[model samples]
Target: MGNFLIVSAGQSLREALSVAENNGVDPKAVLDMLTTAPTLFPSPIYQGHGKRIVEDTQAAPFRQRKIPLKDVSLFTKTAQQVELSTPIAHLLSDLLRSDEARA
Candidate 1:
């Protein structure tokens, strides 16, 4: 799916856990309920972190977006540069690669 799936899923999961907690349901029970869904957790990938690739091309955008200046002191007169780490960088790269790509 187009990147937002993971973010929306996270928000939904947080809300679910909050509700469960409010009703005194154990958090582990909530995770157990999720694992029972065949479609979402068909395999054991949920038990551990999944391996993924990070190709040189994938890192290209980060290199291109690198800040030129070094970090300056808080009270210094010089302007400082800040770097951000986006969780959906790979998805963003795919989305921005073409002119006709739909979001």
Candidate 2:
């Protein structure tokens, strides 16, 4: 659960780091390691959140598949309601909607 929250809320975390840095705080050491997990336990976390599988349910071909963005609009709306800046959520929502429009 902790890993999910920390890894999934990437956009919000970046915004937080920006705010912290602007206020003369330094947390580069902590921020630098979010990309990959430890060598021992690497596969599971990546397979779940970071993998972009073929979205067969969509009309597009296998080559056209993208990351499965789970209900980004609802998630972003909730983020806004909570005064959170989730730029990734908005971007994913826009991308998904545009893809739908293209189909």
Candidate 3:
């Protein structure tokens, strides 16, 4: 499993591919290495008073999909934060750079 961190408000698949190209990573390879993982953060507020205690059991998972670069709404409402490992970042950088090279 490769790690990639994408920092953006929201971008389409094509935009993401462009980013990957700018980062010098292969778009196809990135799609192939894609994985879907969801993470849920529990609410800090307590539901009940002193007599009763209620805990919120909500978990949100991160959804990863292998999509075409032309799809612009892929990154919409995906995640608020992302963290990618070095190798993954490198790959992405390569992709983005390649795109720039073509342009």
Q: Give the winner by lDDT.
A: 2
Per-residue lDDT of candidate 2, residues 41-94 (tens digit): 245443322222212213222223133344455576677888999876666556
RMSD from true fold, candidate 2: 11.1
- The local lDDT score (0 to 100) that residue 75 gets in candidate 1 is 14
Superposed by TM-score, candidate 2 places the C-alpha of residue 81 at a distance from the truth, in angstroms, of 1.3
Superposition TM-score, candidate 1 onto the true structure? 0.36
Candidate 3's C-alpha runs over 4 A off are 1-4, 7-12, 15-85
Query: Per-residue lDDT of 1-103 in model 1, one digit per residue for the tens?
Result: 3223332233345445557767898755665666555645433432221111012222321122212111111112221233434444433333333312331
Q: Model 3 scores what on Cα lDDT? A: 0.30
Q: Choose 1 or 2, whichever is better by TM-score.
A: 2
Q: Count the backbone clashes (under 3 Å) in each candidate.
A: 0, 0, 30
By summed lDDT, which 10 consecutive residues of candidate 3 come out lowest?
A: 45-54
Name the candidate, 2 or 3, with the larger TM-score value.
2
